[model samples]
Target: MPGKHVRFSRNTHFQSPPTPALSFSSISPASSYAPLTPPVIPNNYLPGPSPYTIGYAPIPKAPTIRVHPVLEYSSHQNVDFDILNHPSSITKNRRLLSSLVLSEPATSTPLRSMVITCPHLPWIITVYPQSGSHITVYDVFYEIYRSLHKSITSSDFASLPSDSARRASTRAYEQRYSRHRSSRHRDEEKRSGMLRIDFLMGMTRFAGLSPTGRGPDVWQLNIR
Candidate 1:
């Protein structure tokens, strides 16, 4: 009976079993995964037109130019005669001087004296008693026309030794003939036939006149 009492003692507490270690080797190679989905865009949304598009851009317009009408004259003689009766007193004096220089005998002592006494003609004239009696007004005019042609079209400034002299001569020539070249001057000259002769002395200054009336010549008035 004692032996049976000693063997009857028992435990009341319960114990859990040990857990297995986790590793990649434990995972299945043929395991199924869900496929990735893309984000959704609105159907109404659209991109703007690119600046690089050629036909889509507007073309620029060309600039408009305004041109003035050129004035026309009847004849060259009408134009030439107009300078004599110009409204401008200065122009009249200059034209008168030119006329006198061209028309009058270059060797006439009295004419030379008159030109000398007149404050306008600065060039000194040594009248050699030789008369331009044979040279008529028509001849002088013809010579003038020839000189004008040479002055206008001829590029012969080779006679002038210095550049400064050439330039000065060129400028003087331009100033003298500028009126003849202009359409307005031509029109005015043509209309000035009825105007009175009011020759104002010392009203204008003539440039490029040689002091001795010898050299540095542009147009030769070969009336002598």
Candidate 2:
């Protein structure tokens, strides 16, 4: 065999130049002078209306409320006695009283009345309107009978002594020996000027100031 032809093939591949390492310190001061730009917002994105803008105002709306019928004066006077017996009706009575006093006026007559029965016995309280926004409780009497039509004294009067007189008798009894009790009695005497009864329910201020609520025999109406 002829001597094998020895041939050596030359390796021909292009070699790229080595890249330079980049750093903040390595960057020139002049090259850093270029401004940093904000990130580009996507094409589909949009800013919403501002809260302070008039165009974004809240829609006006009338409240959807079940307006309960105004409790008429007739219905009010004819209150069930069972409601007075039950403690749950206190809240209802409060609400009704407030609504009647504030929203619905006693327009028909010069005087208007409603009854709320005491737990055990029937007591009639007479209220008189004073010059100031105050009510003076003239008298409170215990009733003998539950009669609505007949006069308070004729059929129902039981002649109970006034609260003030009872209070005075108690105070006098207490101040017999104690000097402190005597001083307190004097203070109480000064404080016992007028029985200013103020009934505040919700926003209603039950001051004896209305003409319809004034006048004599206002307490004749059966509350219970």
Candidate 3:
């Protein structure tokens, strides 16, 4: 047993290798570096033309509509939109509304006066150029309107007074007449005794005596 071959154990004769220490000064920041990027526009964003021109613009050279009410309800004047003096007739977004009357000439004579029985109701009058073709309701009304326009724009044009003015004038005239009548009646009362002297005398002659003793005469004839 003493002569057995001696075997050297590796662990008993070996030493542990030394480990390197970590140092904070030798650390590098290569992993922390980042690139900057521009902001992203949303997908739903929409662009448009100038928003200033989206509003309404005034129409050029449009005739000023002057609505003069001659009836009780001028707003009710309704006519087909097709029956106007359209020089360069183009359909427009805006329309004119009014209650007016255009005068029509009588069948036998040119009477351009609007003959209305009741001026209190609403009505409209439109003017149209003369047409060589057959007459329609529109034609008639248009012709009437032309006549009225001509008459209105002429030097001899005179509109009738309104109801209020007419009523006031009539009342004044009646009052004056009443005052005249009352004065005339008072004068008649004053002259009544003088006018009856002659008639009484004539009657007294037959009845035997007159209270004033005067003869009957034309100036003193008893009218009452």
Candidate 4:
């Protein structure tokens, strides 16, 4: 311990042994030299955009509404349109309308339902036979009308199956109803509007008040 020594001098640098005293390999300039470099990436910059196109996936448009061929299939007697098709009159079955002249077929099943709404109007009709019960027979009329109304209000008649006879029938039914519906709305407004005025006057009378005079006892016209 007395002979052991260490030195620090401004003029001389301390050197490591040629290789670490514990290892056999010789030290070389390549092994000893290292540069104090900063890290590979700094925090400020963001990653660049990807090579793949930056955009929304092109939205595929919905396929154009397709209308199928207006097909007339005399439904099997026992199924689908059975109860609705068969009514009490055997002679009045579709054979009557089927026998009518200047008739043609339509392209769609729904369109076929449009034909036979009016008795007076010219039509190439296909009849829906009715059930035996009185209640059901009456209901057939209502159901037919409801079906027609729904068909008219629904999207487009272009999709209806094409049949010359069927189309003509549908046209007649639609034409008759168009006139009827227009007049019906006009009549309703006339009736309801007058009834509303009558109701207001009745209320005023019951309350023992007149609209012309003022006060809590007098009726006030609340024109909304």
**1-224, model 4: which lDDT tens digit per residue?**
15422111122122211111110111122223245585687779767978887555554542221111111112222112211122222122244222111022211111212222221112222323232211111222223322322222112323334445334434333333333357876443333211111111122111111122222111221211
Q: How would you encode candidate 3's per-residue C-alpha lDDT over 1-224 as one tens digit per residue?
A: 24421111112111212212211111122233245585886889855766576554544432221111211122332222321122112122344322112221111112122221112112233322233222222233333223222211111111223545334433422332233357876443332211111111112111111112121100010111
Tens digit of per-residue lDDT, candidate 2, span 1-224? 14411111122222212222211111112222345587998989987877784444455543221111222224332222221112113233434323223222222222233332222224444332222222211111111111211122212222224545434433432232122346776454333321111000011111121113323233232222
Off by over 4 Å in 4: 1-135, 151-155, 162-174, 177-224
Candidate order, lDDT descending: 1, 2, 4, 3
Q: Judged by TM-score relative to the true structure, which candidate is superior, 1 or 2?
A: 1
Between candidates 1 and 3, the one scoring higher on TM-score is 1
Q: How many clashes show up in model 2?
A: 1
Candidate 4 lDDT score at position 71: 15
- The digit string of per-residue lDDT tens for model 1 on 87-180 reads 1222323353233333333221112121111222222222221233233222323322222222111223433446664445444433433447
> In lDDT terms, which candidate is top?
1
On the 0 to 100 scale, the lDDT of residue 189 in model 3 is: 30
Alpha-carbon TM-score of each model against the true structure: 0.22, 0.18, 0.17, 0.18
TM-score of 1: 0.22
Clashes of 3: 3
Q: State model 2's lDDT.
A: 0.25
Q: What value of lDDT does candidate 1 attain over all alpha carbons?
A: 0.27
Best by TM-score: 1
